[model samples]
Target: METSLETVALFSLKLAYEEEGLSPILRDDLVMGDYQKDVFELLVRRGDVETIQFKLNQCLGLAMDALGGAEKPLGRELRKLSADFGEVRSMEQLNQPLLALKGYLKDIL
Candidate 1:
């Protein structure tokens, strides 16, 4: 079967989150960043919002794991993100996480 755009977008976000975002933070032995701003920024600009929301909802746990693996500002933020996004059932609910991720990414980067 052909891959859906939503799946492709989700995979892209997750992959970039791991490669460009989480990996750097983890490798450096520091834990005060959320990473993935670049990817998310790109996603926000180039990706469909519905797709982004779907991916976020479907793959949120992976992001959570990446962010929650530490005891720092980013980690705290991740906890907050988890709590905030856990109840997301609509695209609008994703606004906070997406914006927050962008903001954190700005600060960290």
Candidate 2:
């Protein structure tokens, strides 16, 4: 779950910030400090679903903007999935939506 969360953040950052001449954002990059696997591990260990979702929402929001927001088809679907993710209220319900978002982000990239 932590890995999936990290992957989603990484993919979202790649979509939001990666450019032709700029360096790509890797998981170990300083920019990822807040969204890194260890950060997520701690969140998971404490069962802090709200903070986890908040972190993911930050990245996903950027990714949605990069995808051209709700006006675009892909962005619309991303919005829907993100809404679904936002609806998750417990750790047990996190995996499905998290994986779905991760997979969508990966596919778009």
Query: Could you say which candidate leads in TM-score?
Result: 2
lDDT of 1 by residue, 1-109 (tens): 0122233234324433646534443322222122233444555566445545555544444544555543766657655755564555554456665555545434443
TM-score, cand. 2: 0.96
Considering every candidate listed, which one attains the maximal lDDT?
2
Off by over 4 Å in 2: none
Deviation from native of the Cα of residue 89 in model 1, angstroms: 1.5
| lDDT score for residue 32 of model 1 | 14
Clashing pairs for model 2 are none
Q: How many residue pairs clash in model 1? A: 0
